[model samples]
Target: MQTDSKWGIYEPEKACPNDWDLFQSYCYYFSVDESNWTDSKSSCQNQESMLAEVVSTEQLAFLTTKAGEYGSKFYFLGGSDIVTEGEWIWTTSRTNFTVTNWTPSAPSDDKGKENCLEMRKGAGYQWNDVHCDKNKTYICQRPLL
Candidate 1:
Protein backbone atom coordinates (compact mmCIF):
# COMPACT_ATOMS: atom_id res chain seq x y z
CA MET A 1 0.00 0.00 0.00
CA GLN A 2 1.00 3.66 -0.53
CA THR A 3 0.07 6.99 0.98
CA ASP A 4 -0.43 10.48 -0.35
CA SER A 5 0.77 13.56 1.45
CA LYS A 6 1.01 17.26 0.81
CA TRP A 7 4.30 16.58 -0.96
CA GLY A 8 2.56 14.06 -3.17
CA ILE A 9 3.11 10.28 -2.92
CA TYR A 10 6.19 8.69 -1.34
CA GLU A 11 7.53 5.57 0.31
CA PRO A 12 8.29 5.51 4.05
CA GLU A 13 11.35 3.29 4.09
CA LYS A 14 13.80 5.93 2.83
CA ALA A 15 15.94 7.93 5.24
CA CYS A 16 16.30 11.55 6.10
CA PRO A 17 19.66 13.20 6.78
CA ASN A 18 21.47 11.93 9.87
CA ASP A 19 20.94 15.32 11.47
CA TRP A 20 17.21 15.39 10.91
CA ASP A 21 14.86 13.70 13.33
CA LEU A 22 12.32 11.13 12.25
CA PHE A 23 9.01 11.10 14.11
CA GLN A 24 5.93 9.14 13.21
CA SER A 25 5.83 9.13 9.39
CA TYR A 26 7.61 12.41 8.85
CA CYS A 27 11.05 13.97 9.02
CA TYR A 28 11.55 17.22 10.92
CA TYR A 29 14.14 19.97 10.97
CA PHE A 30 14.10 22.47 13.79
CA SER A 31 15.79 25.67 12.67
CA VAL A 32 17.67 27.79 15.18
CA ASP A 33 17.73 30.83 12.93
CA GLU A 34 15.11 33.48 13.53
CA SER A 35 13.05 34.95 10.74
CA ASN A 36 9.59 36.33 10.07
CA TRP A 37 6.92 33.83 9.08
CA THR A 38 7.33 34.45 5.36
CA ASP A 39 11.09 34.02 5.46
CA SER A 40 10.76 30.97 7.65
CA LYS A 41 8.41 29.37 5.15
CA SER A 42 10.84 30.25 2.39
CA SER A 43 13.71 28.69 4.31
CA CYS A 44 11.73 25.49 4.70
CA GLN A 45 10.81 25.55 1.03
CA ASN A 46 14.49 25.80 0.11
CA GLN A 47 14.99 22.58 2.02
CA GLU A 48 12.11 20.86 0.17
CA SER A 49 9.81 20.99 3.18
CA MET A 50 7.38 23.43 4.74
CA LEU A 51 6.84 25.02 8.11
CA ALA A 52 5.80 22.26 10.47
CA GLU A 53 2.13 21.43 10.70
CA VAL A 54 0.66 20.20 13.97
CA VAL A 55 -1.42 17.25 12.90
CA SER A 56 -1.94 15.69 16.30
CA THR A 57 -1.25 16.22 19.97
CA GLU A 58 1.28 13.41 19.90
CA GLN A 59 3.23 15.07 17.10
CA LEU A 60 2.95 18.42 18.83
CA ALA A 61 4.30 16.84 22.00
CA PHE A 62 7.27 15.40 20.13
CA LEU A 63 8.08 18.80 18.66
CA THR A 64 7.72 20.54 21.99
CA THR A 65 10.08 18.13 23.69
CA LYS A 66 12.73 18.73 21.03
CA ALA A 67 12.08 22.46 20.97
CA GLY A 68 12.70 22.94 24.69
CA GLU A 69 16.43 22.30 24.19
CA TYR A 70 16.62 25.24 21.78
CA GLY A 71 15.37 27.65 24.47
CA SER A 72 12.03 29.35 24.88
CA LYS A 73 11.01 31.16 21.73
CA PHE A 74 8.13 31.35 19.28
CA TYR A 75 8.36 29.01 16.31
CA PHE A 76 6.38 29.55 13.16
CA LEU A 77 3.82 26.83 12.38
CA GLY A 78 2.24 26.03 9.00
CA GLY A 79 -1.04 27.69 9.92
CA SER A 80 -2.39 31.12 9.17
CA ASP A 81 -5.57 33.11 8.69
CA ILE A 82 -3.72 35.57 6.48
CA VAL A 83 -6.18 34.95 3.69
CA THR A 84 -9.14 35.82 5.94
CA GLU A 85 -8.72 36.49 9.58
CA GLY A 86 -10.44 33.94 11.86
CA GLU A 87 -10.34 31.26 9.17
CA TRP A 88 -7.16 29.41 10.05
CA ILE A 89 -5.77 26.84 7.67
CA TRP A 90 -2.49 25.00 7.19
CA THR A 91 -0.87 26.60 4.21
CA THR A 92 1.29 23.59 3.46
CA SER A 93 -1.26 20.88 4.05
CA ARG A 94 -4.06 22.78 2.37
CA THR A 95 -6.54 21.27 4.78
CA ASN A 96 -8.72 22.67 7.50
CA PHE A 97 -6.97 22.18 10.82
CA THR A 98 -9.04 19.56 12.63
CA VAL A 99 -7.03 19.61 15.82
CA THR A 100 -5.11 22.27 17.73
CA ASN A 101 -3.38 22.80 21.05
CA TRP A 102 -3.83 26.39 21.99
CA THR A 103 -3.21 28.04 25.32
CA PRO A 104 -6.16 29.50 27.18
CA SER A 105 -7.64 32.64 25.70
CA ALA A 106 -5.41 32.37 22.64
CA PRO A 107 -6.24 33.09 18.99
CA SER A 108 -7.65 36.30 20.37
CA ASP A 109 -6.36 37.73 17.13
CA ASP A 110 -4.91 40.63 19.17
CA LYS A 111 -6.91 43.59 18.00
CA GLY A 112 -7.61 41.56 14.89
CA LYS A 113 -4.04 42.00 13.67
CA GLU A 114 -2.62 38.53 14.12
CA ASN A 115 -2.92 36.11 11.24
CA CYS A 116 -0.07 33.63 11.58
CA LEU A 117 0.19 30.70 13.97
CA GLU A 118 3.25 30.06 16.12
CA MET A 119 4.07 27.72 18.97
CA ARG A 120 5.21 29.45 22.14
CA LYS A 121 7.54 27.61 24.46
CA GLY A 122 6.42 29.71 27.41
CA ALA A 123 2.90 28.51 26.77
CA GLY A 124 4.05 24.94 26.76
CA TYR A 125 4.23 24.88 22.99
CA GLN A 126 0.58 25.74 22.62
CA TRP A 127 -0.54 27.61 19.55
CA ASN A 128 -0.53 31.38 19.54
CA ASP A 129 -1.85 33.72 16.95
CA VAL A 130 0.78 36.26 15.96
CA HIS A 131 1.63 38.77 13.33
CA CYS A 132 3.21 37.26 10.26
CA ASP A 133 5.99 39.84 10.36
CA LYS A 134 7.23 38.78 13.78
CA ASN A 135 10.64 37.19 13.64
CA LYS A 136 11.00 33.78 15.26
CA THR A 137 12.68 30.43 14.96
CA TYR A 138 10.78 27.74 13.03
CA ILE A 139 10.45 24.05 12.30
CA CYS A 140 10.16 22.33 8.93
CA GLN A 141 8.69 18.94 8.10
CA ARG A 142 8.36 16.61 5.14
CA PRO A 143 7.02 13.13 4.61
CA LEU A 144 9.54 10.39 5.32
CA LEU A 145 10.48 9.40 1.80
Candidate 2:
Protein backbone atom coordinates (compact mmCIF):
# COMPACT_ATOMS: atom_id res chain seq x y z
CA MET A 1 0.00 0.00 0.00
CA GLN A 2 0.98 3.63 -0.64
CA THR A 3 -0.17 6.73 1.14
CA ASP A 4 -0.87 10.08 -0.47
CA SER A 5 -1.18 13.09 1.79
CA LYS A 6 -4.19 14.42 -0.05
CA TRP A 7 -5.85 11.26 -1.36
CA GLY A 8 -5.14 8.81 1.43
CA ILE A 9 -4.11 5.16 0.98
CA TYR A 10 -3.90 3.30 -2.32
CA GLU A 11 -2.24 0.21 -3.65
CA PRO A 12 1.03 0.35 -5.58
CA GLU A 13 -0.83 -0.32 -8.80
CA LYS A 14 -2.97 2.75 -8.16
CA ALA A 15 -0.05 5.11 -7.88
CA CYS A 16 -0.18 8.04 -10.29
CA PRO A 17 2.47 10.22 -11.85
CA ASN A 18 3.11 13.68 -10.47
CA ASP A 19 0.30 16.16 -11.23
CA TRP A 20 -2.07 13.43 -12.39
CA ASP A 21 -5.29 12.62 -10.56
CA LEU A 22 -6.07 9.09 -9.48
CA PHE A 23 -9.55 7.65 -9.63
CA GLN A 24 -10.14 3.97 -9.04
CA SER A 25 -7.26 2.18 -10.81
CA TYR A 26 -6.69 4.88 -13.41
CA CYS A 27 -4.68 8.05 -13.53
CA TYR A 28 -6.08 11.01 -15.45
CA TYR A 29 -4.42 14.11 -16.79
CA PHE A 30 -6.54 17.11 -17.58
CA SER A 31 -4.61 19.26 -20.01
CA VAL A 32 -4.32 23.02 -19.59
CA ASP A 33 -3.87 23.65 -23.33
CA GLU A 34 -6.29 23.18 -26.16
CA SER A 35 -5.88 21.19 -29.37
CA ASN A 36 -7.87 19.48 -32.06
CA TRP A 37 -8.95 15.92 -31.45
CA THR A 38 -6.17 14.31 -33.47
CA ASP A 39 -3.50 16.48 -31.91
CA SER A 40 -4.96 15.92 -28.48
CA LYS A 41 -4.80 12.17 -28.97
CA SER A 42 -1.18 12.46 -30.03
CA SER A 43 -0.41 14.61 -27.02
CA CYS A 44 -1.79 11.98 -24.70
CA GLN A 45 0.17 9.32 -26.56
CA ASN A 46 3.31 11.31 -25.98
CA GLN A 47 2.56 11.21 -22.28
CA GLU A 48 2.22 7.43 -22.30
CA SER A 49 -1.51 7.76 -21.95
CA MET A 50 -4.52 7.91 -24.23
CA LEU A 51 -7.40 10.30 -24.66
CA ALA A 52 -9.76 9.34 -21.82
CA GLU A 53 -11.94 6.33 -22.47
CA VAL A 54 -14.98 6.83 -20.22
CA VAL A 55 -16.19 3.27 -19.80
CA SER A 56 -18.73 3.67 -17.04
CA THR A 57 -21.30 6.08 -15.63
CA GLU A 58 -19.13 6.51 -12.54
CA GLN A 59 -16.16 7.38 -14.71
CA LEU A 60 -18.17 9.91 -16.66
CA ALA A 61 -19.35 11.54 -13.48
CA PHE A 62 -15.86 11.69 -12.10
CA LEU A 63 -14.48 13.22 -15.32
CA THR A 64 -17.20 15.81 -15.56
CA THR A 65 -16.69 16.81 -11.97
CA LYS A 66 -13.00 17.23 -12.59
CA ALA A 67 -13.72 19.25 -15.70
CA GLY A 68 -15.87 21.54 -13.62
CA GLU A 69 -12.97 22.04 -11.23
CA TYR A 70 -10.68 22.72 -14.20
CA GLY A 71 -13.15 25.33 -15.47
CA SER A 72 -12.75 24.32 -19.11
CA LYS A 73 -15.82 24.73 -21.28
CA PHE A 74 -15.00 21.73 -23.38
CA TYR A 75 -12.63 18.79 -23.34
CA PHE A 76 -11.90 16.24 -26.04
CA LEU A 77 -12.42 12.61 -25.12
CA GLY A 78 -11.43 9.35 -26.90
CA GLY A 79 -14.64 8.80 -28.80
CA SER A 80 -15.18 9.36 -32.50
CA ASP A 81 -17.12 8.06 -35.47
CA ILE A 82 -14.77 9.21 -38.20
CA VAL A 83 -14.27 5.73 -39.59
CA THR A 84 -17.92 4.70 -39.63
CA GLU A 85 -20.57 7.35 -39.33
CA GLY A 86 -22.80 7.00 -36.27
CA GLU A 87 -20.75 4.11 -34.99
CA TRP A 88 -18.78 5.72 -32.18
CA ILE A 89 -15.72 4.07 -30.74
CA TRP A 90 -12.91 5.04 -28.44
CA THR A 91 -10.14 5.69 -30.95
CA THR A 92 -7.30 4.51 -28.74
CA SER A 93 -9.04 1.53 -27.17
CA ARG A 94 -10.89 0.58 -30.37
CA THR A 95 -13.87 -0.26 -28.17
CA ASN A 96 -17.49 0.64 -28.74
CA PHE A 97 -19.32 2.65 -26.09
CA THR A 98 -20.94 0.48 -23.46
CA VAL A 99 -21.79 3.47 -21.29
CA THR A 100 -22.79 6.92 -22.48
CA ASN A 101 -24.11 10.22 -21.12
CA TRP A 102 -24.93 12.16 -24.26
CA THR A 103 -27.10 15.22 -23.90
CA PRO A 104 -30.58 14.93 -25.40
CA SER A 105 -30.74 15.57 -29.14
CA ALA A 106 -27.01 15.73 -29.23
CA PRO A 107 -24.66 13.91 -31.65
CA SER A 108 -27.01 15.09 -34.32
CA ASP A 109 -23.78 15.08 -36.37
CA ASP A 110 -24.75 18.57 -37.38
CA LYS A 111 -23.99 19.21 -41.07
CA GLY A 112 -22.54 15.69 -41.24
CA LYS A 113 -19.27 17.12 -39.95
CA GLU A 114 -19.48 16.49 -36.24
CA ASN A 115 -17.49 13.36 -35.47
CA CYS A 116 -15.37 13.93 -32.36
CA LEU A 117 -16.69 13.65 -28.81
CA GLU A 118 -16.49 16.36 -26.18
CA MET A 119 -17.82 16.98 -22.73
CA ARG A 120 -19.54 20.32 -23.17
CA LYS A 121 -20.42 22.98 -20.59
CA GLY A 122 -23.57 24.10 -22.37
CA ALA A 123 -24.89 20.59 -22.27
CA GLY A 124 -24.60 20.47 -18.48
CA TYR A 125 -21.26 18.74 -18.88
CA GLN A 126 -22.76 15.92 -20.91
CA TRP A 127 -21.22 14.39 -24.03
CA ASN A 128 -21.58 16.08 -27.39
CA ASP A 129 -20.23 15.34 -30.84
CA VAL A 130 -18.52 18.12 -32.73
CA HIS A 131 -16.09 18.67 -35.57
CA CYS A 132 -12.84 16.82 -35.05
CA ASP A 133 -10.84 19.86 -36.06
CA LYS A 134 -12.19 22.06 -33.32
CA ASN A 135 -9.67 22.86 -30.64
CA LYS A 136 -10.48 22.04 -27.03
CA THR A 137 -8.74 21.08 -23.84
CA TYR A 138 -8.49 17.32 -23.31
CA ILE A 139 -8.31 14.62 -20.70
CA CYS A 140 -5.89 11.71 -20.84
CA GLN A 141 -5.99 8.45 -18.94
CA ARG A 142 -3.79 5.46 -18.21
CA PRO A 143 -3.84 2.60 -15.79
CA LEU A 144 -1.80 3.29 -12.72
CA LEU A 145 1.48 1.47 -12.64
Candidate 3:
Protein backbone atom coordinates (compact mmCIF):
# COMPACT_ATOMS: atom_id res chain seq x y z
CA MET A 1 0.00 0.00 0.00
CA GLN A 2 1.23 3.48 -0.87
CA THR A 3 1.86 5.75 2.07
CA ASP A 4 2.62 9.44 2.43
CA SER A 5 5.67 10.05 4.60
CA LYS A 6 3.94 12.80 6.53
CA TRP A 7 0.35 11.64 6.61
CA GLY A 8 0.93 7.87 6.80
CA ILE A 9 -1.90 6.26 4.80
CA TYR A 10 -2.02 7.93 1.41
CA GLU A 11 -5.29 8.85 -0.20
CA PRO A 12 -5.85 9.01 -3.91
CA GLU A 13 -5.39 12.44 -5.36
CA LYS A 14 -8.45 14.25 -6.60
CA ALA A 15 -8.67 16.81 -9.36
CA CYS A 16 -8.42 20.36 -8.17
CA PRO A 17 -9.05 23.47 -10.22
CA ASN A 18 -6.14 25.44 -11.61
CA ASP A 19 -4.01 27.07 -8.91
CA TRP A 20 -5.50 24.79 -6.30
CA ASP A 21 -3.54 22.04 -4.58
CA LEU A 22 -5.07 18.78 -3.46
CA PHE A 23 -4.39 17.44 0.01
CA GLN A 24 -6.27 14.53 1.50
CA SER A 25 -9.91 15.13 0.46
CA TYR A 26 -9.72 18.88 0.06
CA CYS A 27 -8.44 21.46 -2.42
CA TYR A 28 -6.54 24.42 -1.07
CA TYR A 29 -5.99 27.79 -2.72
CA PHE A 30 -3.26 30.13 -1.61
CA SER A 31 -4.08 33.68 -2.59
CA VAL A 32 -1.45 36.22 -3.59
CA ASP A 33 -3.58 39.28 -3.11
CA GLU A 34 -4.15 40.78 0.31
CA SER A 35 -7.46 41.57 1.95
CA ASN A 36 -9.06 42.00 5.32
CA TRP A 37 -10.55 39.04 7.15
CA THR A 38 -14.12 39.73 6.06
CA ASP A 39 -13.09 40.45 2.48
CA SER A 40 -10.94 37.32 2.43
CA LYS A 41 -13.84 35.22 3.62
CA SER A 42 -16.10 36.73 0.97
CA SER A 43 -13.48 36.11 -1.68
CA CYS A 44 -13.26 32.44 -0.74
CA GLN A 45 -17.05 32.15 -0.80
CA ASN A 46 -17.03 33.62 -4.28
CA GLN A 47 -14.59 30.91 -5.29
CA GLU A 48 -16.85 28.21 -3.83
CA SER A 49 -14.58 27.75 -0.85
CA MET A 50 -14.11 28.97 2.67
CA LEU A 51 -11.12 30.40 4.51
CA ALA A 52 -8.66 27.57 5.27
CA GLU A 53 -9.42 25.93 8.59
CA VAL A 54 -6.54 24.20 10.39
CA VAL A 55 -8.20 21.48 12.40
CA SER A 56 -5.17 19.41 13.34
CA THR A 57 -1.44 19.59 13.86
CA GLU A 58 -0.83 18.06 10.46
CA GLN A 59 -3.20 20.50 8.81
CA LEU A 60 -1.46 23.39 10.50
CA ALA A 61 1.92 22.13 9.38
CA PHE A 62 0.67 21.78 5.82
CA LEU A 63 -0.59 25.34 5.81
CA THR A 64 2.54 26.74 7.42
CA THR A 65 4.71 25.10 4.81
CA LYS A 66 2.47 26.31 2.01
CA ALA A 67 2.56 29.86 3.36
CA GLY A 68 6.35 29.83 3.08
CA GLU A 69 6.16 28.64 -0.52
CA TYR A 70 3.70 31.45 -1.25
CA GLY A 71 6.10 34.03 0.22
CA SER A 72 3.47 35.76 2.30
CA LYS A 73 4.22 37.49 5.59
CA PHE A 74 0.82 36.70 7.03
CA TYR A 75 -2.29 34.87 5.91
CA PHE A 76 -5.78 35.16 7.28
CA LEU A 77 -7.31 31.94 8.54
CA GLY A 78 -10.96 30.94 9.06
CA GLY A 79 -10.77 31.55 12.79
CA SER A 80 -12.09 34.58 14.58
CA ASP A 81 -13.37 35.67 17.95
CA ILE A 82 -15.17 38.74 16.75
CA VAL A 83 -18.51 37.76 18.24
CA THR A 84 -17.02 36.89 21.61
CA GLU A 85 -13.54 37.79 22.73
CA GLY A 86 -11.13 34.93 23.56
CA GLU A 87 -13.47 32.32 22.11
CA TRP A 88 -12.01 31.61 18.72
CA ILE A 89 -13.98 29.57 16.25
CA TRP A 90 -13.78 28.61 12.62
CA THR A 91 -16.20 31.03 11.00
CA THR A 92 -17.30 28.67 8.24
CA SER A 93 -17.79 25.58 10.40
CA ARG A 94 -18.88 27.66 13.40
CA THR A 95 -17.08 25.14 15.59
CA ASN A 96 -14.90 25.80 18.58
CA PHE A 97 -11.16 25.34 18.16
CA THR A 98 -10.25 21.84 19.24
CA VAL A 99 -6.63 21.90 18.08
CA THR A 100 -4.61 25.07 18.16
CA ASN A 101 -0.96 25.98 17.41
CA TRP A 102 -0.85 29.44 18.79
CA THR A 103 2.54 31.07 19.30
CA PRO A 104 3.54 31.68 22.86
CA SER A 105 2.02 34.86 24.32
CA ALA A 106 -0.24 35.23 21.30
CA PRO A 107 -3.99 35.68 20.90
CA SER A 108 -3.49 38.21 23.60
CA ASP A 109 -6.40 40.08 22.07
CA ASP A 110 -4.06 43.01 22.14
CA LYS A 111 -5.83 46.13 23.37
CA GLY A 112 -9.03 44.07 23.30
CA LYS A 113 -9.20 44.63 19.55
CA GLU A 114 -7.41 41.68 18.01
CA ASN A 115 -10.00 39.08 17.08
CA CYS A 116 -9.00 37.60 13.73
CA LEU A 117 -6.67 34.60 13.28
CA GLU A 118 -3.58 34.79 11.09
CA MET A 119 -0.54 32.67 10.41
CA ARG A 120 2.29 35.14 10.75
CA LYS A 121 5.86 34.85 9.60
CA GLY A 122 7.02 36.79 12.63
CA ALA A 123 5.31 34.24 14.76
CA GLY A 124 7.21 31.42 13.04
CA TYR A 125 4.07 30.63 11.06
CA GLN A 126 2.15 29.80 14.20
CA TRP A 127 -1.30 31.20 14.86
CA ASN A 128 -1.79 34.71 16.18
CA ASP A 129 -4.68 37.08 16.73
CA VAL A 130 -4.74 40.38 14.97
CA HIS A 131 -7.28 43.00 14.06
CA CYS A 132 -9.80 41.66 11.60
CA ASP A 133 -9.55 44.78 9.46
CA LYS A 134 -5.84 44.29 8.89
CA ASN A 135 -5.22 43.34 5.31
CA LYS A 136 -3.30 40.11 4.64
CA THR A 137 -3.02 37.33 2.15
CA TYR A 138 -5.30 34.35 2.77
CA ILE A 139 -5.80 30.67 2.08
CA CYS A 140 -9.03 28.97 1.02
CA GLN A 141 -10.15 25.37 1.01
CA ARG A 142 -13.03 23.29 -0.29
CA PRO A 143 -13.87 19.60 -0.28
CA LEU A 144 -13.26 17.54 -3.38
CA LEU A 145 -16.63 17.11 -5.02
Candidate 4:
Protein backbone atom coordinates (compact mmCIF):
# COMPACT_ATOMS: atom_id res chain seq x y z
CA MET A 1 0.00 0.00 0.00
CA GLN A 2 2.74 2.40 -0.96
CA THR A 3 0.72 5.01 -2.80
CA ASP A 4 2.78 7.97 -3.98
CA SER A 5 1.77 11.36 -5.34
CA LYS A 6 3.06 13.08 -8.47
CA TRP A 7 2.88 16.61 -9.79
CA GLY A 8 0.12 15.64 -12.26
CA ILE A 9 1.30 12.80 -14.45
CA TYR A 10 0.27 9.53 -12.68
CA GLU A 11 3.05 6.96 -12.41
CA PRO A 12 1.56 3.47 -12.47
CA GLU A 13 3.81 0.58 -11.55
CA LYS A 14 5.70 -1.42 -14.15
CA ALA A 15 3.22 -4.33 -14.48
CA CYS A 16 0.82 -6.61 -12.58
CA PRO A 17 -0.85 -8.85 -15.15
CA ASN A 18 -3.71 -10.90 -13.66
CA ASP A 19 -4.17 -14.62 -13.47
CA TRP A 20 -7.94 -14.61 -13.59
CA ASP A 21 -9.81 -17.88 -13.49
CA LEU A 22 -13.19 -18.83 -12.05
CA PHE A 23 -13.00 -17.63 -8.47
CA GLN A 24 -11.86 -14.12 -7.62
CA SER A 25 -13.16 -10.97 -5.98
CA TYR A 26 -12.47 -8.95 -9.12
CA CYS A 27 -14.76 -6.07 -10.09
CA TYR A 28 -15.79 -4.91 -13.60
CA TYR A 29 -18.29 -2.82 -15.54
CA PHE A 30 -19.10 -1.57 -19.03
CA SER A 31 -16.71 0.50 -21.09
CA VAL A 32 -19.11 1.42 -23.93
CA ASP A 33 -22.42 0.91 -22.24
CA GLU A 34 -25.52 2.93 -22.94
CA SER A 35 -24.75 5.23 -20.01
CA ASN A 36 -22.39 8.12 -20.51
CA TRP A 37 -19.01 8.10 -18.83
CA THR A 38 -20.27 10.57 -16.26
CA ASP A 39 -23.36 8.51 -15.61
CA SER A 40 -21.25 5.41 -15.46
CA LYS A 41 -18.96 7.06 -12.98
CA SER A 42 -22.00 7.96 -10.97
CA SER A 43 -23.21 4.40 -11.11
CA CYS A 44 -19.97 3.21 -9.65
CA GLN A 45 -20.18 5.94 -7.06
CA ASN A 46 -23.62 4.75 -6.02
CA GLN A 47 -21.94 1.48 -5.27
CA GLU A 48 -19.69 3.37 -2.87
CA SER A 49 -16.85 3.66 -5.36
CA MET A 50 -15.87 5.45 -8.52
CA LEU A 51 -14.30 4.22 -11.72
CA ALA A 52 -11.56 1.59 -11.33
CA GLU A 53 -7.84 2.41 -10.95
CA VAL A 54 -5.40 -0.26 -12.02
CA VAL A 55 -2.05 0.08 -10.25
CA SER A 56 -0.16 -2.77 -11.91
CA THR A 57 -0.22 -5.02 -14.95
CA GLU A 58 -1.76 -7.82 -12.90
CA GLN A 59 -4.54 -5.57 -11.70
CA LEU A 60 -5.01 -4.29 -15.22
CA ALA A 61 -5.32 -7.79 -16.60
CA PHE A 62 -7.71 -8.78 -13.85
CA LEU A 63 -9.91 -5.75 -14.49
CA THR A 64 -9.90 -6.21 -18.27
CA THR A 65 -10.75 -9.86 -17.88
CA LYS A 66 -13.40 -9.10 -15.33
CA ALA A 67 -15.07 -6.82 -17.85
CA GLY A 68 -14.92 -9.56 -20.44
CA GLU A 69 -16.34 -11.99 -17.96
CA TYR A 70 -19.23 -9.64 -17.36
CA GLY A 71 -19.88 -9.39 -21.13
CA SER A 72 -18.45 -5.90 -21.50
CA LYS A 73 -16.07 -5.14 -24.35
CA PHE A 74 -14.54 -2.12 -22.69
CA TYR A 75 -14.96 -0.32 -19.39
CA PHE A 76 -14.23 3.12 -17.94
CA LEU A 77 -11.49 3.51 -15.41
CA GLY A 78 -11.42 5.85 -12.41
CA GLY A 79 -8.81 7.89 -14.25
CA SER A 80 -9.84 11.05 -16.08
CA ASP A 81 -8.95 14.69 -16.73
CA ILE A 82 -12.38 16.24 -16.65
CA VAL A 83 -11.46 19.00 -14.20
CA THR A 84 -7.87 19.27 -15.40
CA GLU A 85 -7.56 18.14 -18.96
CA GLY A 86 -4.12 16.65 -19.79
CA GLU A 87 -3.65 16.01 -16.10
CA TRP A 88 -5.57 12.74 -15.84
CA ILE A 89 -5.23 10.96 -12.52
CA TRP A 90 -6.98 8.23 -10.58
CA THR A 91 -9.61 9.20 -8.06
CA THR A 92 -8.49 6.60 -5.50
CA SER A 93 -5.30 7.20 -3.52
CA ARG A 94 -4.19 9.34 -6.45
CA THR A 95 -2.34 6.39 -7.96
CA ASN A 96 -0.80 7.34 -11.33
CA PHE A 97 0.26 5.45 -14.40
CA THR A 98 3.80 5.46 -15.66
CA VAL A 99 2.99 3.16 -18.60
CA THR A 100 -0.01 4.63 -20.30
CA ASN A 101 -2.10 2.32 -22.49
CA TRP A 102 -3.29 5.02 -24.85
CA THR A 103 -3.10 4.21 -28.53
CA PRO A 104 -0.90 6.15 -30.89
CA SER A 105 -1.77 9.86 -30.95
CA ALA A 106 -4.38 9.52 -28.33
CA PRO A 107 -5.73 11.62 -25.35
CA SER A 108 -5.61 14.64 -27.62
CA ASP A 109 -7.15 17.77 -26.13
CA ASP A 110 -9.51 17.77 -29.10
CA LYS A 111 -11.27 21.11 -28.97
CA GLY A 112 -11.23 20.74 -25.19
CA LYS A 113 -14.03 18.17 -25.30
CA GLU A 114 -12.68 14.70 -24.70
CA ASN A 115 -11.80 14.22 -21.04
CA CYS A 116 -12.38 10.54 -20.30
CA LEU A 117 -10.58 7.38 -21.43
CA GLU A 118 -11.97 3.97 -22.39
CA MET A 119 -10.33 0.63 -22.92
CA ARG A 120 -10.73 -0.29 -26.57
CA LYS A 121 -12.13 -3.68 -27.55
CA GLY A 122 -9.59 -6.12 -28.92
CA ALA A 123 -6.87 -3.56 -28.27
CA GLY A 124 -5.27 -5.26 -25.33
CA TYR A 125 -5.32 -2.42 -22.73
CA GLN A 126 -4.90 0.65 -24.87
CA TRP A 127 -7.30 3.53 -24.29
CA ASN A 128 -8.89 6.28 -26.40
CA ASP A 129 -10.46 9.62 -25.78
CA VAL A 130 -14.15 9.66 -24.95
CA HIS A 131 -16.83 12.02 -23.74
CA CYS A 132 -17.69 12.11 -20.07
CA ASP A 133 -21.38 12.35 -20.81
CA LYS A 134 -21.23 9.12 -22.81
CA ASN A 135 -22.97 6.28 -20.96
CA LYS A 136 -20.73 3.42 -19.91
CA THR A 137 -20.10 1.18 -16.91
CA TYR A 138 -16.91 1.60 -14.90
CA ILE A 139 -14.97 -1.01 -12.96
CA CYS A 140 -14.10 -0.55 -9.29
CA GLN A 141 -11.19 -2.33 -7.67
CA ARG A 142 -11.36 -3.42 -4.00
CA PRO A 143 -8.10 -5.14 -3.39
CA LEU A 144 -8.12 -7.89 -0.78
CA LEU A 145 -6.52 -7.29 2.56
The best candidate by lDDT is 2
Q: Write the per-residue lDDT of candidate 4 for residues 21-123, one digit (tens) a residue.
A: 3214443434334577767767667755557776677766665666666666666777777767688887556766654678787887688888887776667
Error of 1 at 9 (Å): 23
lDDT tens per residue, model 1, 1-145 = 3467776776565788666899988999888789999999999999899999887879978999988876648889899998877899999878889889878988999888898998898898888999989899999998888
Query: In candidate 4, residue 60 scores what lDDT?
Result: 67
Q: Which stretches of candidate 4 lie over 4 Å from their true place?
A: 1-33, 143-145
- Model 3: lDDT of residue 133: 92
Which order, best to worst by TM-score?
A: 2, 3, 1, 4
Which is the better candidate, 1 or 2, if ranked by TM-score? Answer: 2
Model 2 per-residue lDDT tens digits across residues 1-145: 6667687867464479998999999999999999999999999999999999988889988998999998899999999999999999999889999999899988899877999999998777899999999999999999888
| Clash pairs (backbone) in predicted model 2 | none
Stretch of 10 with least lDDT, candidate 2: 5-14
- The TM-score, computed over Cα atoms with residue i paired to residue i, of candidate 3 is 0.88
Better of 1 and 4 by TM-score: 1
The residue pairs found clashing in candidate 3 are: none
RMSD of each: 6.3, 5.1, 6.6, 11.2
TM-scores of the candidates in the order shown = 0.86, 0.89, 0.88, 0.67
